[model samples]
Target chain A: MAPLEPWEKVLISADFTQSIHGRAGCVACHRGQQSPDKDTAHVGLIPDPSQDAQRVCGVCHGEIVDGFGTSLHASLQGYRTIVYSRSVPENHPALDTAMQNHCLSCHTTCGDCHISQPKPVGGGLLNGHNVEKTPSMTRVCTACHGSRVGAEYLGKHEGIPGDVHFREGRMNCMACHAGTDLHAAEGDAAKHRYWGDQQPACKDCHAQVGRADDPIPQHTIHGNKLACQVCHAVEYTSCDGCHVAISEKTGNPFFKTEATYLSFVIGHNPWPSRERPYEYVVLRHAPVAPTTFEYYGENLLPNFGLLPTWTYATPHNIQRQTPQNRSCNTCHGNAALFLTADKVKSEELEANRRVIVENIPAAIPIP
Target chain B: MRRVGMLLLILGVGVFLGACASQGISTPTPVPTAPLPEAVLTPLSQTDYCVQCHTDKEALIETAKPEEKAPSESEGVG
Candidate 1:
C-alpha cells in the first residue's frame, strides 16, 4: 500500500471516534509503548503477543478477570500453572508446551491464542486490547480456518436451523437448540452463551414423537424414554405388502413393487451401540441418538467440548465427561429415551409390509 | 378261428380305450411375473432439491465457477 497523504491520515483517524471514546486510542493504553520511541512512557507498554497483555485485559472484562484469578486458566497465569513441563520429573507426559496451546488460548488474547490481527493494528488509547468493533468478528475465525468451514460457524446461530433449509429437508444445526439472538442490550455479553450447553440437543427439542410435528403423548405419559428411532426401521426406505406382480396382459407399462436403501438415516451418525432406535436422524432426526437425559440412564458426562460452551462456564462445571455418552444426555434431564413403542404409538403393534409414504418438511433459504 | 381272432381284436381295442380313460393329458409349464423397478437410487426428497437448487444459485452468486471455490467438493464445470 502506498503511504497515505498526511491530511488523509488525520481524516481517517478522526473518523474512528467510537474507537477513540469507547475503547480509547492506542497510545492511551500503550502509553509510550510504540517501539523505537525515545519517550519514557514506552518502557512497560511494549505489548508482547507471546506473554499476557502487560496491561491486563482485567482493566475491562472485570468479572472475567476476577473469575479468572481463581480459574484453572488463572492458576497457570499465577505461576500456579506452568507450561513446558516435560523437563519436570514430577509432571505427567500428557502435559507439555502443546497443553499450553489448549488452555492458554481459551483465556488469552486472540492474537496470542488464535490468529494474529491485520496490521495498522488499530492502536488507540486501549493500546492493543481488541474492542472487536469489526463489522465482522467472523473475520477473526476465518483467518484461522479459511472462508469456507469456519465462515459457516462464525456467526452466532446463523449456522443453526437456517443452514438446514438447503439440503434434503435437513434440520438447521441451531433450530433444535438455543441460538445467539441479537438484542441490543446483550451483545458481546451473550457471545459465549449460544454455542455453550444452553443449546439443546436435537432430541431434546423434538423429543415428543408422533406425527412429524406432534410429540407422542402416550410415550410421554408412561414416562418411557421416547427415543425417536425406536419404531422407525433403517433397512428398507419404504415397505411393500401386496407382493406386487406384473400383469401378463398389461405389458405396455411395467408394474412392480419397489423400495430403496437409505444410507443417510441408517449410517448418518452411528449409535454408541445397537438396541437403540431403528428409525433415526443423526444430525437432527433425534431418536437413534440422545434426545434427553433418561436416554442417559445415570451415565457419566461428556467433555466440555461436546456439551454447549455455556455448560462449562463458572459453577456449571460440575460433571466430568465420560467416553461413551455424548451430546445432550451428558448434561440435561433424560425424558424421551425412557418411553416405549406401545406407550408411543397409542395402540398395539401395527401390521408390517404395508407400503407407506411420508411427507418430509422443507428447509429455509439464507442467501 | 376267424371268430376267435375278431373277438381278441375287440378286447384289445376296449383295453386300450379303458387305459386312456383313467388319466389326463400333458400340458406346458407357466411363466413367472415381471420384476419391479430396481431401487438402487432413491428419488430425492424435495429438501434435497432445495439444496441442489440453492447450491447452484449460491455457486453462481459466489463464483461462476464453483469448482474453483471447492475444486474437490463439486464438479469441475465452469
Candidate 2:
C-alpha cells in the first residue's frame, strides 16, 4: 500500500463541535458516541455518516435528499444498469455482495460531496473536517471520476491542456454540475447517466456561442443536428472493453481485461434527452464486452445487444475549435470521425449497426 | 617511433572528432512517465469493516479499507 497523501489521512481529532455540523453535536448525527468512552462511544457508530443521511442531513436538507434518492449519484443506476444488463439477477445475493464490495463505495452520501473525502478514491478530510458549501474538486469530484473527465477538465492528462472553462474561467464541477442539477434527477428513472434534462449541457452556459460567429458556416448548418461536444471536445480517453470475473483462487472480484483509447469520434446519439436533442454526438467506446461477465455465469449478458458499446459520450477535453471542425474535409470525408463498420467488433456490429453513420460525404473546402 | 606517434595522434583526433560529431547532434530526451499510483494504505471511511472477511475485495484494497482478522469488539461504529 502507498503511503497516505497529506490529505488522504483522516483527521479524527479535529474540532467538529464549532462547525455547523457540530451544533447538533457528534452524537446527534453519529448516535453511537453517547458514553464518552472511546470504545463505547464508537460502538454502533455508523461507519459512513452519509448512509444515514436521511436522518442526519435530511432534517435540514429535505428537498435535496428527497430528489437525491433518485439522483444519479445515489441511485448509481448507470452501474446498476450495467450489472442488470449483464444478466445478473436483481435479487441475487452475489449481486448485493458484489455491489457492496465494489460499487457501493462510489455511491455518494451527503458527507462525501460536502464534508469528508470521497471513499471510492480514498478517504481523508476534505477541509480538516470543516463542512464546505463548495467542496474542492481535487478532493471530492475528481477523486472518483478522475480517470477521464477529471484529467481532461483539470488538464492533468498527458500532452493535453485542461478544459478552457477550468483553465481560464476557473470553473469547477459546481459551475456546471450544480448541486441542484445533481440532486434533481428522478432517481433510478433517469436510467442512463445522460437520460434527463438535469444533466449539464453546453447550452446551459454557452447558449449564445453557437450563434455568435459567422466565420464557420458548418456551425450554423449543423448546430441542431450535432452536439456541442462533437466539435468542441478534443480527443479523450475511452476504455475499449472490460472483462469482469471472480478469481477462483481468491473468491475476489477482478477484471480480467480492460484497455483504454485516447481519441474521439462522432456517432448517433443513443439517448436524446431534452437537454441534448441532437442527431449526432460524441461517442466513447464503453469498457463492456460480450464476455464481460462470463465468470459470473455463462450467457450472463445474452441480451448485450440491448445496449451499444459505442454510446453517447461527452469527453471533457474541449476547445472552441477542434482539428476536424476547422477543416470541412477533415470531418466530412473522414470516416474516422464517425463510428462505422470497421471501428466496431463483429460481435458488436449487430448492436451498433444502427448507430454508425452510414455514408461519408466527400468534402470540398470552402473557398 | 615518431611516425608511429603521428599515427597514434591521428587516431586520437579521429576518435575526438567522432565524439564531437556525436555530441553535435542532439539526442531526444525521453519524456518522463508519470509515477504509478501508490497502493492506498488507509480506508476512505474509518468505520468500514467489510474487508474483515472479504479480503480479496479489490475496491476495498484500492480504497484502503481496513481489514480485521479477529471479530471486532467495537460496537456502534458500523
**Highest lDDT among the candidates is held by which one?**
2
**Interface Cα RMSD of candidate 2:** 17.2
- Classify candidate 1 by CAPRI docking class: incorrect
Lowest lDDT 10-mer window, candidate 2 chain B?
B69-78
Clashes of each: 41, 13
How much DockQ does model 1 earn? 0.00
Model 2 - which docking category? incorrect
Residue-level lDDT tens digits of model 2 in A171-223: 88888887777775754345767765636767677566558655666768787
TM-score per prediction, in order, is 0.29, 0.75
lDDT for model 1 comes to 0.28
Chain B TM-score in each of the candidates: 0.30, 0.32
